[model samples]
Target chain A: NAGVTQTPKFRILKIGQSMTLQCTQDMNHNYMYWYRQDPGMGLKLIYYSVGAGITDKGEVPNGYNVSRSTTEDFPLRLELAAPSQTSVYFCASSYLDSSYEQYFGPGTRLTVT
Target chain B: GIQVEQSPPDLILQEGANSTLRCNFSDSVNNLQWFHQNPWGQLINLFYIPSGTKQNGRLSATTVATERYSLLYISSSQTTDSGVYFCAVVSSGGSNYKLTFGKGTLLTVNP
Candidate 1:
């Protein structure tokens, strides 16, 4: 199974523009997360979903939003992109009972100018 | 909030040498895992070792929960092992699903 898949492997956005980073998992995982990593730094969680329709904020969720309408999909929206949002984003999923052993997809490299 | 720290920041090892990387967490955690980020930037899961010890080929990991730290041991290292190693943890209870990653240890093995 393609454990997890993310769309638009790379993207560049202008200031005030918007875009969506899509993530999907065929494993039917009950948990999904969005994280961003700056150059030479650790990842910072932007948002997470326990199940479809249940979402929560994480450490750095200011410029991003997420929606989980189905068990197989979680999409992150950048409403008004800024240069500060430039980074690499990763999508991950895991089973409910796994206690957070996640499967990460190939990351999306995003640049906001 | 929990803090995760990994060391020695940077390491350069000769081929066939052995090395150990460390991770220290500031609070109790429900889950822990190790990941290797290769040159191309893909994160590969190495081990899901919250406690105890586990071995996989030339690599091994030991997490001493009581001490709030974990160690990853690599034996007979090769050039292919050159990459960044990260330690991520999830806090106990409902927040256990969110992982906080360390800055990572950069390992370079020269032939």
Candidate 2:
């Protein structure tokens, strides 16, 4: 069902480089999220959107930006990639029902040198 | 910021063994979920239990909001169950959909 899809499975960027991580969900869920997983660390929220045209920052939103212009797409933008931003990024979507279960993408592994 | 703690950072179990993973949060949450991230980095949802118990096949979960703790039980564990188990909670306020995750429990199953 291609529940959630993230583009650029892998990327290596030099410091100051910029790139966008694309995420799309076919479930038409209202909630979408961006998280980064460091080595041996759990997922940390970078940003999240409750619905289209509404977005907010999360715990570790310092090096990233996000926009939710449509229900099917929520993209994370890295304006000036830094070494600290190197990590595996995961995109997820949820229906916000009683279960509150989130479906995640395969993930994007990024390394900033 | 809400704190999440997962017990037994590392676990080793033989095939067919049973195990329980624990997660304790610093505050009450509107959402709590368990996920299994395999070696390949694919995250699979195991449960979305804010409270009460729910089971799916050989896996089950229980979240006690009042006690600020949750337990995930894995029965008859197989090699496929070897991965990182994560517990995440979404606190009240505008961050309801944003999850705060624990360090995770890494399970290694020996067949």
Best by TM-score: 1
Every model's DockQ:
0.72, 0.69
True contacts kept of 2: 0.75
| lDDT for each residue of candidate 2 in B29-64, tens digit (9 for 90 to 100) | 888999999999999999989999999999999999
Model 2, TM vs. native: 0.94
Fnat values, candidates in order: 0.69, 0.75
Q: How big is the positional error of residue A49 in model 2, measured in Å on the Cα after superposition?
A: 1.4
Candidate 1 local Cα displacement, residue B26, angstroms: 1.8
Q: Which candidate has the highest lDDT of all? A: 1
- Listed per model in order, the count of residue pairs whose N, CA or C atoms clash below 3 Å is 0, 0
Which docking category, incorrect, acceptable, medium or high, applies to candidate 2?
medium
Per residue, candidate 1 scores C-alpha lDDT tens digits across B15-72 of 9999999999988888899999998889999999999999999999999999999999
List model 1 lDDT by residue over A29-98, tens digit each: 9999999999999888899999999999988999899999999999999999999999999999998995
- List where candidate 2 sits over 4 angstroms from the true fold: A96-99, B93-96
